[model samples]
Target: MLGQTAQLRYDFPFLVRTDSLSFRNVSLADAILFTLTVTLAWFISSSVCQYFRLRHFDGPLLAKISNLWLFSSVNSGRSYLDFWQVTQKYGTIARVGLNDLVTDDPAFVKHMCNVKTEYRRSSWYDGMRFNPTSNNCLSTRDEIAHSALRSKMAAGYVGRDVDNIEPKIDSNIRDFMRLLGSYADKKTPVDLGRKVQYFTLDVISDLAYGAPFGFVETDTDVYEYIQTTEKNLPMVMVVTVFPWLLTLLNSPVLKGLLPSTKDRLGFGRIMSIAKDVAAERFKLDVNDARDMLASFIRHGLTPTEAESEILLQIAAGSDTTASAIRSTMLQMCSNHDILHKLRREIASADIAGDIISDNEARKLPYLQAVIKEGLRIFPPIAGLMSKEVPPHGDTWNGVFIPGGTRVGYSIWAITRREDIWGADALEFRPERWLNNSPEKVKEMESTLDLIFSYGRWLCLGRTIALIELNKILVEVCS
Candidate 1:
């Protein structure tokens, strides 16, 4: 018994010493070193795994790590240029994010965006969603839902129906020209970009809500419209990479805490404007409402649905059209010969003094070419329009991309391709689109439509936008 007890005590002491060494004797420095070692190991293994996963494709190292590369590129306002550089280095299919590939190849653009393909808009669009739970037309990702909503809202934006809204556009354009005249009379330089934006905002507001925001007459952005849009747009680009962050940001508590000026400019405020317009129109029993909201309601949209649709129109339509207008104006100012030729065309028209009708402007070849050139040179939404590859996986430009990869066409790159448009592709030249041969012009038209985003998700406001652009160009040149 004594021998057994002695043996037990000896073993117990060894066990205690081992336990103390293993659990209780770890110093802070040691713990830190151990943690760092594990972390380094994990990082190396992860990088190696990622490298093998992306072995078929090529891109910068940072792009393979996380979405930060894309987020930073876009948030820094250099995505267009950055895309140019990356695509130049990596060729057609370059990894812009861990799962995102951007291609400049025109064939890839057609195949990926084709309606027959299984590509749908990626989660990046979710960043633009008003309510994380609910979706407006612009932010809806579901194909069937987008189709149904589009069909419901399609009649409201038909090209032929745009003539009915010509009066509203003319009124705003007259006010805008008068304001510009005042600026010219004073011999003071005006921020033409801001002025152009105000004009578009007023015009679109009139169409969407039945009344203008009064920016032209007041010569101010009364609702701080430009400031709000500027602040909020960056967030949309950021969340496109780190989409999980969207949920946290959109959470009520985080939103309340951060509380940016942009947050206040969300769908809630847009919806409020929509509600007020509807109330006023119904209260006054206004005769034969010609505005977009009325058209939406007439075409079977519920009150909430109508409000959502108009909100999309006002938010999406205003700034983009304004950008195109400003870009065209800037290009014209820089190119004196183009401006002179266009103005001469306008002056030769029989109704020179009167506001030119869209139909009449369409007949003016130079004007049409200028508009096409402007659209190609500065597509308003000049960033990646991401689409997710289908579950079956697909091959693009000879590279086999696995299923669920996010892919997009870089319109910025494609439009600037020197090979397609010649050495002067970077230069703003309208004649490229004015090819004399009908077949050649038809081909060019198809190319521009691709940049404007063709297929099932074609821009709905295209017809109205073209009409506005035609009239505004005539008025400005005159």
Candidate 2:
């Protein structure tokens, strides 16, 4: 019995010593070193997994391992050119980030954006939200919800449901011309870009509400809208590169830092204006009204939804059309031959008054070609517009893309492809549209139409923008 008790006592002391060794105190440096080692191991493993997943696709070495490459490119303020350069070097399908692939393939873009496409918008679109608490049509990622919202707002955008769209447009054009005339009289160098912006804003505002914002009449950047947008848009675009940042910004804690309707300048002021206009419009009987707000109301949009969409119209509608105008004008000014051709076409066309009718402008073949060519060279919105792959995965040109990958369009590269638009694609040659065969023209037209997007995601503002373009170019040139 004594021998057995001695053995138990010895074993217990040994076990206690082992336990004491296991719980030894770790120094601060040791703890930090251990944490760093674990982090490094996790990072390396993660990079390896990501690299192998898309190792078949070629991109910058850094891009294959991190999103910092993309963030840096976007911050350079010429991301469109950088993206184009990437595709030019790596062919149609090129990796731009750890999990992001961009393609200049029109067929692939169309397939992903088709009416019944399974691809949903990527989380990148979350950065497009104007209101931190709300998702505008541009930021809505769910296909069903986007479609529903589009349906409610389609009538207002289509112009058939709204009254006096052209007259309102003509009125704004008159105001635009008068403003330019004053500039000409003064013999001062006018900033055509700023004036063009004013014209577009006035036109859209007149169409949306019953009256214009008087940007042309006042001859200034109303509410500092231009300055604010210039400063804020780049930062907003930067946020899109990091999905987690968007989540953090939109979260309840940080949401208070974002723009609100009460702010006295920039987007918030515009939002405040929209809210006030919407409030007044909502009090009227729907049957007695004829503007876009009324059309939205008649088509079953609630006051809050209408307010959001009206703000969208003012922001998106004005800027895109302004870009189209400025680019087309710049192209014409740069090429005397093209400018002469356009002027000749406008001068020869039969028009009823100072402003050319949309129908009249459409009949002018050269003018139409000029518009198309301009849009091709400079697509207004150079955004990535990334779409997420379906859960089951997708294959393009026999390359298997893993599920949950983000595929964005290289819009600049696509528009400048030598194969599609011929060797002179980079040049602003309107003759390409006029010289092609009917089938060729049809193909080119279909491809160019992608500037407004395609299928279920086709832009609702397309018709309105076209009307503005069709009138403004002819009137200005004449």
Candidate 3:
């Protein structure tokens, strides 16, 4: 019994060590399991909170917890159609993201964009920066800064301080007409899409720097600029969806991946051109030239600001105006009646030259109506120009929206709303503008004007765009 007791005591340490080993193995497994369980719980809880925050708003099932729906739609290259469909399905106000809502309500868009409104530009504008380090007029969110910038640029864009703006545009139109005559002589198919883009680019450049970029004269996409823009737009649009991604892309570690002025192609080449032009203007006496760049410098714009704003003008002015021209031309061609009617109006009007003047174009009711209808059917910019809710929160359409929520304009949806534009809203009918009663026509015009935006955010290039449209459409139709 003594020996057995002694042996038992000796083995007790071995038994205890074995038990400790087993306990350690179990604890390690338990720790891993506990960590994974907590992580999953956190994700689930976060999703639930997000889902309930905007539960009152209707949207795709996936949008309640993720931005995947929005991302996928944009990635599909049919965001315009997809977004319009969503609004059509879910009413005027619809949830498009976890914290994002889009509305086709013109009143909502007007309220948000009012000069003195509490709403401010969203972070989405951050992704609009051509240079990650700088802010152009369109990308700046600081209200005071934007207002000041707009003041300096307004004179130039309105052509109030620039000379020969119409003559410069006509010069480009002449180049375009010459090109078309050549194509006609050869009986070759003219790619109006490419040619129109060239015309607009050249006109913008000529107005901007007192010399065209020669896009129309050369009859080519110089430096592959248009091709690059088409390629990068989708990705740039996707980046705007995630503000953090934009911040990171602009960060020191990743900014190297962005386009640089040093590059010899695409936007980089355009930046280099703008910089060179600005440098030359800076070398000359400020009073020596009276173009857009000079106008900007006269208004106290810094050299850097001048360059940035000029690039903005080239980019914003050219593409949007080109789009308007293309859509209008397509509509006219599709309906020979509209085309013949427009041509007759231009023919009967007293014009001194081949190129119709802006004043004359304005007098042609059918032409003006056709332009408006084109813009209405397809707004030049279909992106979600979102505005952030005020910190104090506000009610929209009787719904109390929480602060920090983002409300974007579904401009495509708004422009096509049957409630606003009538039963045939989707049709490309110019008569809607003419046949309506005076008050109704006025309302329709006001709604269509929102394409240029409203109040403090009204497009500075609005006048120039109109002048281009008024002149080019008439010339083409004639």
Candidate 4:
């Protein structure tokens, strides 16, 4: 039996070889020693593989223990810099540490999701636990769990219930424009990114949790807490990428060693709120549908289930939209030619003086192009999407992405690769997306990064997001 398992294991890189070989002829005590010996061999070989360079690549310094630290090091703002630099030197793929592999290849995205839930969503997101009852869209690590919540929320996402979102978005944009106009009137150069963050927080919270978390409408230090929270997301995601280090970091005495205790407390506040809402909303029934809170109640999520779902929704929905808006505004301001062209396109539209209707906004082409360009340049959640390597491929592009090894898609790298996007790939040029030359357009999309990702795991809120964004961009810019 042991020999058979070993033979099957050899078909994949994730298997660790044990030197004790077998206990078939051994006494119970001797077999124990052999098991210990095998464990030690496995550890030694893995450590060596983690630290030393092989024929194909030299691992990054962080990679050496990046997995050990579980990427919770709080230094990923700079780590991102190291990652780009290393991937550059090592070519497109590099060994990220003991157990992680990050690849920037475009085709890799499709390849990674090949298996059904091949890789779990990671455990550290359990940090999202605001309360025991809290269960919403984002925190559930199981694909099966996510599907159940998504099905309940499908009315607000795929079906007519989301149609109500259209009016809600219109009102939010009106409020957003009013806020921005006041800033512009004072000649305030507000951080467009931060303001967009506040705007989306207000919008998505209104949609998801039944009202604003008061990120924008309310004046409190909680707003500051919200800002700090987003700035810490890349770091938070790092913890997800590498989890074992989190256990090490959480050691009682070592807790004080990290700089993100504020994040810990803020998450507590978020969970407490989720619990409060879930407790209150659980009493309501199906006909009570006023918003998403009631929708979940009707859909039959227990109060605790609803709370968790809320956590997931807020995490997934808010920041990405805000980032897209920030990137769009910056991209527009930076490119005068495209900017002027877009401005002209806006003015040329007959709806200029009229309240920009969503339907009318749909008529504008340049704005749509600009939005796509923004996603390409600065995708808000431009983090990696991970998967478990299959046994057949020990590694992609030469490095062994062992079967149990978690692999990631470097979103920024794929979007900017010369082979994928053309020589001016990194440039924020919207016109490149225009379908002028059939050959050129085909070349561009063959690199086909939707930025929202693709196929089964693709984002469901995409259509709603586009509608909300287009309405606001046109109304405000017009």
What TM-score would each prediction reach against the true structure? 0.86, 0.91, 0.91, 0.77
- Indicate whether candidate 1 or candidate 4 has the larger lDDT: 1
TM-score, cand. 1 vs. native:
0.86
**What is the lDDT of every predicted structure here?**
0.77, 0.86, 0.85, 0.63
Q: Candidate 2, residues 184-219: lDDT per residue as tens digits? A: 999999999999999999998888777888889999
Off by over 4 Å in 3: 1-46
**How much is the lDDT of residue 68 in candidate 2?**
85
Residue-wise C-alpha lDDT for candidate 3, range 1-478, written one tens digit per residue: 6565556546643332332322222456666887899999997897788788889999998987888898888777888888898899998889998888888889888999998899999887877777666889999999999999998888888878888888899988999999998999999999998899999999998887779888888888998899988888887788768867877887899877777889899888888898888888888887756778888898888878878887888888899999999988998889998888888988889888778888888888998999899899888887787889999889976898888788888789988888789999879998988988999998888888889988879999888999999998887878
- For residues 1-478, could you state the per-residue lDDT of candidate 1 as single tens digits? 6565556556654322432333245568777887999999997787667656666777877888766688889899879888878898998889887778888887778887777868888887777664444477878889998888887777768733333588888889999999999999999999989999889888888888778978899998766666766876777677777678777976877865333323345444555676667666555432365556655665666666665666677778888899899999999999999999999999887664468888889999999999999988887876687888888888765678888788877887887777677688889999887754787677667777775576787888888889899999988876
Q: Which segments of candidate 1 are over 4 A away from where they belong?
A: 1-51, 130-133, 159-163, 257-268, 278-288
Q: Tell me the deviation in Å of residue 257 in model 2.
A: 3.5
Better of 1 and 4 by TM-score: 1
How many pairs of residues in model 2 come into backbone collision? Answer: 0
Candidate number of the best TM-score: 2
Evaluate residue 455 in candidate 1 and report its C-alpha lDDT on the 0 to 100 scale.
79
Best-first order by lDDT: 2, 3, 1, 4
Query: What is the lDDT, from 0 to 100, of the residue 449 in candidate 3?
Result: 84
- Clashing pairs in model 2? none
